[model samples]
Target: MFVDSFSRWMKLYGMRRKSDTLAFVQKFLADMSGTGVPRSFWMDNGGEFVSRDFIAFCDNAGIRRTYTAPGTPQQNGPAESAIWRVNKAGHAARLEAPRLFPKIDFTRVPGFGRDGERLWRESCHWAAGGFNRSPTKANVGRGTCV
Candidate 1:
């Protein structure tokens, strides 16, 4: 997942391929077409992020690309925190599975709620909402919406 430090907005992904990363950025921009492009895009020193095609795309889009120092995740604390919180939630969800779905046999059914999708979506929303409620300096200069 890629999280915006100031806004606490996140883009979750199932894979981390270079093409997938680029496609995610493109889709996000298309989805928020009129909001204006971000001034810069930050990421870790991952192969997918450093791909030549991705760099070209960002350049063409007029977005500056920034990479965090190797082995220094603290340089991107917001994203790290967001990932931690979501992983913690996932652990809690897994531990609560037996108690919450006692009637369902995991050996056969292997699903939560109506289906697996609902549980995943609910967990994501829960994490994102919690992140959004966290204190941040980004909104201080933006306006009252913070």
Candidate 2:
């Protein structure tokens, strides 16, 4: 998943493969609502982002790519923190599902059954709601305007 710092919007992918990353980026660019193509992209030094194909794609799109220093993920702190919060929301949703919807028979959801699909859907809603309702810090002085 990738997070936009200013808008706090996220684009999530089901797969972790490089091809999936490419597809996500393509979709993000095409589907962006308010903002146009970003001036630059900041990411960790992952093979998926550094691959030849990805590099060419970014070059063609005219998007500057900046990578965090190896082993220093803090340089991409906002994205990292967003990832953690998203995952935590998933965990919290899974734990709360049975209690909140006791009659749903979560064990029979099919496919990735046993609450898998339901949990994922619920988690996404919960995370988005939480993010929207949360107050943004008033830090115009520091340029943290989300």
**What TM-score, computed on C-alpha atoms, does each candidate reach?**
0.72, 0.79
- For model 1, the local distance difference test gives 0.70
lDDT of each: 0.70, 0.74
- Top TM-score: which candidate number? 2
Clashing pairs in model 2, backbone N/Cα/C closer than 3 A: none
Model 2: lDDT of residue 31: 74
Among the numbered candidates, top lDDT falls to 2
Quickly count the clashes in candidate 2: 0
Worst 10 residues of 1 by lDDT: 109-118
